[model samples]
Target: MNLATHAALLGWIPVVLLLFASLPPRRALVAALVGGWLFLPVAGYDVTGYHDKHMVLSAGMLAGAVAFAPGRLAAFRPRLVDLPMTIWCAWPFVSSLANGLGAYEGGAAVLFNTARWGVPWLLGRTLLADRGGVRALAVGVLTGALVYVPLCLWEIRMSPQLHAALYGFHQHAFDQTVRWGGTFRPMVFMHHGLMVALWMAVGSILAVALWTRRTLRDVGGIGMPWIAVALVGTTVLTKSTGAVVLLAVGASVLLLADGARVRALLIVLALAAPAYMAVRLTGEAPRTAVLDAAARVASPVRLASLRFRLANEEQLAAKALERPITGWGRYGRWIAYDDQGRAATPDGFWVIALGQFGLVGLAAITAATVLPVVRLAVRLRRRRAAAPGAGPAVALGVVLALFAVDSLFNAMTNPVYFVAGGALAGVDVRSLVRRRRPAAAQGRAPAPVVVAGAALASPAGSAR
Candidate 1:
């Protein structure tokens, strides 16, 4: 059965709307609307998929109504921190219009993708930035990983030719093949082995944060160490060298940022030892063997895989140089040349962004995206040091670290990444704006609230 077809998409419309309605008055409903819109593509209803654009519009209208509802609308206001990044990130779309490439319909693609993925994440952050929401997101991520990891293990066991058919053998061709305890390598719902590896790496970083902060205690009776072991093990099974490196780097950053000097060192050594053993077993060498070896031990198979990635990076770099200013345009590198031109790398996020958006676009996009994450990391560190037991700080730090690593090789601007990133960004923006409230309140007197029939009447006496 095409499960997508059997699910009733329209049913979710009201359900999502209700969820927005139920939120606290001070909460941002635009986030909910944006997030609800993001799920439209994946929402199929009994052989008839709901119109995605329509869903987005409806959600937006509902959210806007809620936001404009007198006192309810206070949460929807954009903050100073949000403005800079939003404008910076939007520059690419703006530039796309300025360039002749705008005619190619890059705007539609960007908008569609952004709505499908970015909106939900922004809403998730807005909704879940509170201690309760942050915990929910953390649990949701771990639960999703738990469910996804086993499915990946099953896929690996099946050794399905699906990946080869979809992404092609070149993109997923690994240097080594190992059937661990009769279990094959898992690909799960992702496109390739590398993607799976990336997911696992993300899982590991999150698990570490959750474990260290004792967030697992919230789950009742679940041991933190066991969760960490499972996450780390899954990362190893994916056999993605880049992902492994990213996990290590991300975890290290998280630990050091959190000031767990001894624990961080111990965790690093523990995670590194097995990787070293794997490398020793494989015997094949990686392109950046020294760096890879220092981070984690690699087997011959792992080494070969790492070498392939480095080679792809080199090729992508050269191609980017050819069109240093404005990339050949979105997906332009994917256009094959008749033995006359070089092609884009098969699996490289930086290369894709650079090749598609050019150096100017890349710099602008990177700054827009990375700046908040860096700030969050710094803020979390300060917050935790000053006030202990701030688990949300650790969780945010984990998210930033994971993104930092994942973005290196994967186009995290994709749907999932955007959604998550948007949510985190929303939270950051909300917190910043709320902080200025005290000083602002001292200057201007507060307005009185008037409620009517589950909705607040605006100051102008209009039902918001």
Candidate 2:
């Protein structure tokens, strides 16, 4: 079938499943249907992008289900998970208004992006705050990886020139013109390679979680090491240095947090660096001749990346000074013309926030993005120490760490980030609720006996 036909079919499948979910015999069917819907193939089928189509269809189904079936809706009520973060995210809207930058269409842009992320986030908070949501997310990641890995492999094999032609690497055409590499890195369905890499990184992390927990062996018949190896290999093939760094850092954090000896952790990190450098040096030539010599060592590649990022950072800083308070309005750079009638680079995310909305706007964006992840981290540590068997908390912590690291390099405004963020928020909010509920505290026991037993049974159990 064609792409549109496939999308329409998949989209309708959910609706039919919802109908069945409303029936007594097939209520368990909805969960599986949702899981399957998330991983359905859309490779050749470009029916308005699978994610976009799924979002639209899912929204419609959710609305209809809520209207027709209050009981089902109640099953999806917002949990206490990450409520603080949800509240914090509201600051951007307020800051936009305060800075008076929202006067033009810029306000609308802020509102639109915020709503796009915030709404699903809220929905996720309600629907996914429980074990089922956790399972759904895990299943989705594994399924997405299963589908995405082979496609990525094929694209790399094809080395299609069309990849760059379609995506347009770097921020501007001039960068592409100046660079030695192809126009864009391959992104079969995602917006860019960085995004694809980020998604793969998340998969790799999830794979770690699955392997460590022994879930992969039980469910997928795959050993943990094999899953980890596959995920790490896929990440490397993406040619995203940032993603590689993220994986390294995230893995380290996971290892330390899980109580690996500090000295052993340091030794592992120290040894891993040289090995990583060797592999990276041999991977690909630099983007420019000047960078090629530097690529002889990994430090140069890292420095070059940092330098470009810093340049963008500097440019943004200069622009922000022009309107430090309210700054430029939304799409203000587009509409607000200078004496020379030239537009400047939007630069990095920090600069984008400042230039677009000014200092006030930047602060709002910062709080919204930072607070929940921080709160989640703190809460996870406390919860894990007190209870210990909180799988969802551990997973959420990994998600937070990945986002925190990746956001420094790429914008966190993508759909994948939002979807993941929403799920994490849901988990966090639920944890908070459990902590606050007097009845829950009084009745709840320490971390589950199963987790404690597992910890004692095997040395590898410490990996989780």
Model 2, span 290-343: residue lDDT tens: 355556766765766766754454455566657676665554552233458645
- Cα lDDT, model 2, residue 182: 47
lDDT of each: 0.48, 0.48
Model 2 bad stretches (over 4 Å): 1-107, 160-184, 215-219, 259-302, 321-326, 332-344, 359-361, 380-389, 426-464
* Tens digits of per-residue lDDT for model 1, 342-422: 553455455566566566655544443444454444454343432323444444444544554455556533333443444
My TM-score estimates for the predictions, one after another, are: 0.64, 0.64
- Residue 218 C-alpha lDDT in model 1: 23
lDDT for model 2 comes to: 0.48
